[model samples]
Target chain A: MDGITVLIISNNIVLEKDIEMSADSKEKQLIKKAKMGDENSFESLILGCQGRAYNIALQYLKNEDDALDALQESFIKIFRSLKTFNGDSKFDTWVYRIVVNTCNDMLRKNNSRKNTDSIYWNDGEKEAVLEIPDSSNAPEDLYDKKEKRDHILSCLEKLNPEQKEIIILRDIHGFTYEEISEILNCSIGTVKSRINRSRLRLRETLLEQS
Target chain B: MKCDKTREMLSLYIDKMLDDNLKKEIEEHISTCNLCKKEYDDIMEIVTHLNEVEMVSVPKSFEHRLKNALQHERSKISDSKIIAISDKKKNKLRMLTSIAAIFAVGLISVGLYQDIIGGVTDQLDGTAQLAQDQVMQERVMNNETESDLYNSKLYKSNLDEAIDEKQKFEIKLDVADDVQSSDALKPRMSIYGYTDDNSEPGSTKALVPENYVDNPSVDGDSDGYSKDYSTMMTSEEFSRALTIQAIERNVAAVQFYKGLIEDNLRDFNYEILESDFVQAGECRFRIYIFNSKEGYVFNEEIIAIGKDGEIEFIYTNEFMGL
Candidate 1:
């Protein structure tokens, strides 16, 4: 497997470059090679997808350490199950599914251990920290936007596990309904219904908060 | 088109799931119907707000940590394999030494026994009888101990089995467990029971298990119950109950697959060998079509329970055209 070593210049620069080449054909090619037992190709694929995978794990698990553990476990699973990838869904969607499963497993384990203190951030904490895009609004509107974003996260927390997953994938990750359906191993009709219901619940949650 | 029908399709329209023709119909209806248009606008606003929500980035060290962990796992696996190989070699050597020592001991014992023959055999027989009695007593005691141990194990296992069975029964009845509240629980329909009851209504009471008596209303026909009891469940309630069962079955299928994979305990990955697509089973689902009275539009939640008792959900936009 052909591997590319990306030199970390700076955070902002790396983030920009990652966004630019995020959907490059080379990444898929690397993933294909990695799936065929090429460690180097697998390494490159990991390097490319690691950020997003970690972000997803973080979103689900909340704790930095748990997120890290999930990320590693997810990568190992990806390596083991790479041969099962049929390219029916986007590589990212497949990767995200693995991450989500890993996170869920971790959540179950943590629940069994009664470890509630590790990742219990409410929607307010997430909103206060994360930045939201507001193209039409001025600097004065930034505070209100943040509050709304926080409200949304709080609403997200109230959703059922399945609803949360679908909403996050569709609204946050920007996955298409078809891609989500394939990743979730459900019919397209089921996927749409879940998204629709989840959105309604989210709206209800926000309205209730107001 | 009726305002209610137009309102039901508003979500699909926002989702872009509606066909072009249906979309045009909804658009036309919205133009004339203020209530429908207002509902549509509200849903769109919510969708837009959700879309604008930002995602948090993963920590910078996340990738590095994953790569390091993978490397560590690989090393550990390789090390264990090497250790196992070396251990096998050591065991073979130890076995050879033990065999040589056993042969040496047997040869020396035989020589000693041959030298002390004659009257010693008679005395040995007398002593052996007494020793045999002692051994028999010991054996009986050992057997008793073993039986006691086995019985204790059986007792504990039986207790566990009882608990599990009771828990499963409660879950089936929508009863609350120790871990969670069950106040808002809904009853689930059973496909096999439904078929059996539908075939013979009077016999439904006999077919139902004793545990199901607590939640007898799960039976769609209510088993020829009074009209008051029948009115307790709305049409939507009937559909929802059915959909829940369907979701349970669906989830059970997946759980069965997971169980098979876990049972093998092999590291081998699954491949799509072959698939036979068929739908032979009866619709074993409780379909909950909410907001049905207002219009034909309904949100259906199907619960499918598989043979293994695992539950899965399948929500559908059955009334998208309404």
Candidate 2:
């Protein structure tokens, strides 16, 4: 029985690796075609990464419209400058970097014209930006899960942008430290320390919110 | 390791990023230290919850909007490329013009500029005017009377106003040398047929009707030079001149011939996206007709008009990506 279990585990690892290799090769093919001005290839290339990109934008901006704007702008910048992408880093890392930079630029631009009327800021100085979900109509287990999720997300908003960016990149998006380093254009050591500090800051925010 | 050091490396410990010895040491410290263990547990729980946080999927309209945005960017890049090519050509022309001006000034200093260049220009003008007068005299001799000249079967006009205009135009050129004199100042219609000297009579070629006076400074006017005699032409004559230039030479006039081309293509439902002269003798135009409700270009055609009034398809492509 033990021998059989070991064999199955080893086979599964090989299968996963094969799948990853195929996916990477396919992405490389798409990037090559997209660089040569194939619109369909470009569309296909961004389709896979756009979801996580949108989510990152949404988390940073805390507004759907602003997130969408950032996504559209980032995609355009990516398409226009696609030839400059040398493929040193992963495609998705480059995409996310552009998205993050676009969002940062928008945040800086809108800082002076900040919309104080956001629903996130509606509950006065003490209240968290996002309200806890109305769990009364939901199943007890489901509602509990949702409340915890919302609470954590709201607490995420309370962190500084740097802390929030690192947490979202590491914990939420599941980018490895090396990938995060590439995306953030920092050393592996910096990414590690930043993630550690960001996670600690996030923990403090979550505790304070509860 | 103490509790503080263990806490500092707790996130990395949970991530399994610490080296083997450090991982072992942190694990041992956390096991012995209750405070460090609690901190480690809290951080672990937060990371777990963060990983479990529901991600926002893009709206349904996002891909479509992004594709449109990307298409727009792609078009802008292509337009900039076209502009860059045009600018490069303009820069070369400017450099050549400067060189020619310097050469002309040197000729002026040597007192040979007027004798050589001016004498050639005057001779060319005289020869062109002589050719026009001879053609006019031959037409008068063939008709036998001015009224018969107007009534000749050789002249075909779909519109009555066009016939009246042509008759008035011929009379004006025949009676007045001043009108003929002004021909040098006005735009000269240099017409060429699509068929080359070697090409068979029925074979399709590019019809070019170009204006040399528009850029008379350029010396390399390879457009076949059939001079138009009417100095001050009407818009109707202008249109006919352009169309005849296409039929005569296979090249087109200047950019304003767009309206005339559109009018001629009114029978077809295709919209002219862009029209351009491909070469000295070839006219190439991108035309499209939308088929889908979404308004994507379904059928695209690039066509050139031959001298014999035949339409030659240069390219017929379906499913042009917007």
- Cα RMSD of all models vs. native, in order, equals 31.1, 21.3
Cα lDDT, model 2, residue B161:
22
- Candidate 2's DockQ is 0.27
Per-residue lDDT over A1-210 for candidate 2, one digit per residue giving the tens place of the 0 to 100 score:
999999999999999999999999999888888877787888888888989999999987889999999999988877766654656678888899889888988887876685442223222234454444422332334337667666667666656567788888998889999988877778999988888877777676555555
Please provide, for model 1 over B140-172, each residue's C-alpha lDDT reduced to its tens digit, 9 standing for 90 to 100. Answer: 766656334323333323332333233333443
Per-residue CA lDDT of candidate 1, range A137-186, in tens?
32333347566665566556655557777877787776788878766778
TM-score of each: 0.46, 0.53
Give the top-scoring candidate (DockQ). 2
DockQ of each model vs. true complex: 0.11, 0.27
Chain A agreement with the truth for model 2, given as TM-score: 0.77
lDDT of candidate 2 over B1-322, digit per residue (tens): 9877887788889999889999999989988888788788888877888899788789999877876777787789789778755754564465456546655654554454235335434545565455445546757777556444333333212122222222233333344344453363233221211233366543433332232223321222321221232333434554464465344332223232344345334334576676666564445566665332211223545554422222344454321211
What lDDT score goes with residue B274 in model 1? Answer: 24
Worst 10 residues of 1 chain B by lDDT: B185-194
- The lDDT of model 1 is 0.55
